[model samples]
Target: MTSKHSLRNPKDMQYAFSYFYYLIHKKVPFDLDKLWAKEIDINRDGYLNENELRTLAINVFSTPLKPTTFKEFKSDLYKTCMELRHPTPAPVIVEESSSSDSSDSSSSSSESSEDSGSTAAVPVIPATQTATATAVATATATVTATTAPKATTPAVDNNTLEVGQKELEACRIDLEVLKASNKTLMEIHKSYAKRTMYRTSIEGTDEVAFLMVDDNDNSTQTKLDGVRQRRHKFICLNDNINHDKPTAHLVIKVIHDFYESLFPFPSSFELPPGQTNHFRYIHEIIDKKQEENNKNNTFIYIFGVVGVMIVMLMWKRSKRSSNGNHHSINGIIGGVGNKSAAKQRSNKRYMIV
Candidate 1:
């Protein structure tokens, strides 16, 4: 609201509303000074006033903000203002001393508008003006004094307190809607992560998976973005799994390959110092392969040992038999040398060649 400055920026209203949200969130109450600093919402150095405030509330309170964009916020504002102009009377309960008064109130409301009110089964307000309504909410003493300032606004009819209560209820509804929407968006992100994850057995890129190294010298080995290590999502299609998504699969594969090229795993992987979970997932896959290889090597070693032991046993047995036969033949030659006369008679009869 700085004297307009001859610069017509309609988006100013949008920025003001966002700051209004920021301040209210900090639990810092608003006043004129805050507007000067541009921390508070202003329509030329005054609080957006009750009317404008209500308009803002309606937009903020209605259908959930998807992505919470400025455009969405402005759209909500317009919608709320339109709705405030024509309010539907909710079926409200008011402890009344008499039934006739209630009838008079209902008749007045019907006559005031042509729409016949909505049949949405809303709660009805018992009091028509704010003064009496304040009396019920507070103690018995302050109703008359409080009702004076409210006389200017028509919404502060005989059931001013009731109307205030209704406004409060609307505000509560808006709060609930925002909270629920935030939860929904968070859930959607998680769902997206699970379906497109390259967490297991894919081998390289998603194999060792992707990593990110920021200026802080911190490394993220499992995800492309350091911030979302738990659930990283990319668009990929598996033609083998789904026939219609071949193109989708091709697009994703290209991205995966490109990402892997950027953050290839070195011979040794240590996901910096602090990145435990991502490191752990990669480590698990690596550890499984190592364990399998170790098991195979161990089996080979055991077999080689057994084969060597059997060969050694056979060689020892053959050497022992050869030595025994050689000793027996030598013993026969020594005994025959002493019997020469018998040997000569044997040679004559046999005609030795």
Candidate 2:
């Protein structure tokens, strides 16, 4: 959400949020330190102050930001960048090489002292030769021991260098990924910014007012008056009305009256009274069509009733004709039977004679 007093330009706000979201998710593309130094840390002082960041924002977004907005943005950027950064590992402490060197020297001195004591013993021809040989061997062993390689600071330094090289290689890989991500981000920003222009209005100065009034609110007129007094370049009025309420019509009337008060002049599209109200013309047309449909339905019902009555009359006539035909057929058969019976009676009379 953006405030009118802060970064009100929608394009600028959109980009700001996109950048901030990337930071929050640790996907900020560029190395934060590099970005800060290159873009925000003016004077190359290794620290980003308010002025430097504000200048960067204006240059990048092509719009000035409110102080409060800049401060909030800076704080969020600082926090997110800090969270994304990896802490430097502490150096490993190697025990002193000097300590080991001192121990070796003490041992070598003890061996030399033992060899010197053997040399100090009384001389016998064979004993002297054995003592001299033993002393010479001990002296040679001591000299070789003294000259042997001792643990030095350079060896410790080499181990430290290897660990550092590993860390440096890891950092280089991360930096490469970030650089690629940063390049892609820059391209996107350039294309998007070119396609969509940012608003150039001054911060904290708004030319539009948006007012929303509920049907139950009694101070709607007061709000309207305030908007009128401001004489804004544009004004939008929104109503929150419960259409199911009985007083909805009254609220609608109040809204209509307010519009009339604001725009009393006639437009070319408006029709005079008694002529068709274009605003309600659609409703009129719908009502006329409904009435015509009702008349058509009535005619269809009457025609159906007449057709049913005619069919019933034809059915009754057909049934009567069938009954008359059946009666005639029965009378003819009775007449034939009566004649045959009379003939049989006559034949019987003849036989008796």
Candidate 3:
């Protein structure tokens, strides 16, 4: 059976008493009820009174009383029990009639005492009422003090205000100057973009595209159509030029140098012997000859030789026929010469006869 001073269940009461006892003494006692009766039960009537129950509640919910589990349930139970057992204090009301009567009697007594030239007797207020009044006055003063606005410092002087305005104006001037500078810088950037061109990478090739900037500072990118020549120029001129890669500027320089080397100015202008070997003309002629050699075929050479022999044989036959005709004419003339000699000899014989 639970004791009259205990909670609803004997086990819970024992635990509660033991918990509170440990909180107060910092050690669990052998008998929780004996400790509770000795320390908490002020009247020792074997029952917990209002004060004892409030004390027990405070101990149970004290800051150091940290329960490891069921913390929410313990807090709720504690709050519920505290609300049931220790309700809020009701508002105190003094009788207006009694207060007015006391004030009037005090005033009359003070007037009589003052007329008699005696020290005005002090009004004897009850100790409890005086304490309550003092407490109420203190609370009212604290509330008013907290809610009231703090006294501010005096307004800034004219000199300080003038100085601050001057500083603000200087800052505004600086900001305007910065804005103007920024505008000028943007204009310079626009001009630079219009004058400059960029070379960007091309996909699936080691080649790059040249992006030309227009008058409006807009870019137009185009892939180099003749990449082979440009690549050759890049290989040849990369060592001589400062650029690491082929750009429009570098390509232009290469083309200019190549043209100058091929058809120099003044028509008779010649490069130094050392620089002449770097020109492409010699390399181009050598490459053409190599290409022709690579394209040469045995059958074509044989056909050319046969055609040359046939033409030579036809020329020889025509020459031999003409020679034979000339020799026959000469023999006929010799025969005529023999006949003329005979006719001359016969004339001589006739002359002799």
Q: Please list the residue runs of candidate 1 whose C-alpha ends up more than 4 Å from where it truly belongs after superposition.
A: 1-244, 249-301, 331-341, 344-353
User: Top model by lDDT, which number?
Assistant: 2
Query: How much does candidate 1 score in TM-score?
Result: 0.21
Two-way lDDT contest, 2 vs 3, winner: 2
| lDDT (tens digit, per residue) of candidate 2 on 1-353 | 35443534645555555765544444234345565456646677554444665675565555666665554444444433332453333344434344445445555665676678876653323445445655655665566566655443112121112122333233322222323444334633553344322333333437767887777545676777776677777676766778888877776776667667777887987778578644455888798889999999999999999999999999999999999999999999999999999999999999999
How close to the true structure is residue 134 of candidate 2, measured as C-alpha lDDT?
A: 58
Candidate 2 segments whose C-alpha is farther than 4 A from its true place: 1-280
Model 3 regions more than 4 Å off: 1-217, 221-295, 298-303
Write the number of the candidate with greater lDDT, choosing between 1 and 3: 3
- How many clashes does each candidate structure show, in the order listed? 21, 0, 0
Of models 1 and 2, which has the larger lDDT? Answer: 2
The TM-score leader among the candidates is: 2
lDDT of each: 0.46, 0.58, 0.47
Which lDDT tens digits does candidate 3 get at residues 1-353? Answer: 24454335534456545655545444232343454446545666554433554454444444453433223322333333333443444434433454445556655765676686746555555557656655665665566556554444222222212122333233222112312334323432343333212333324434442333222211111222243345432221222232444354655554555456544654456655556444456788698778787668666888899999999999999999999999999999999999999999999999999
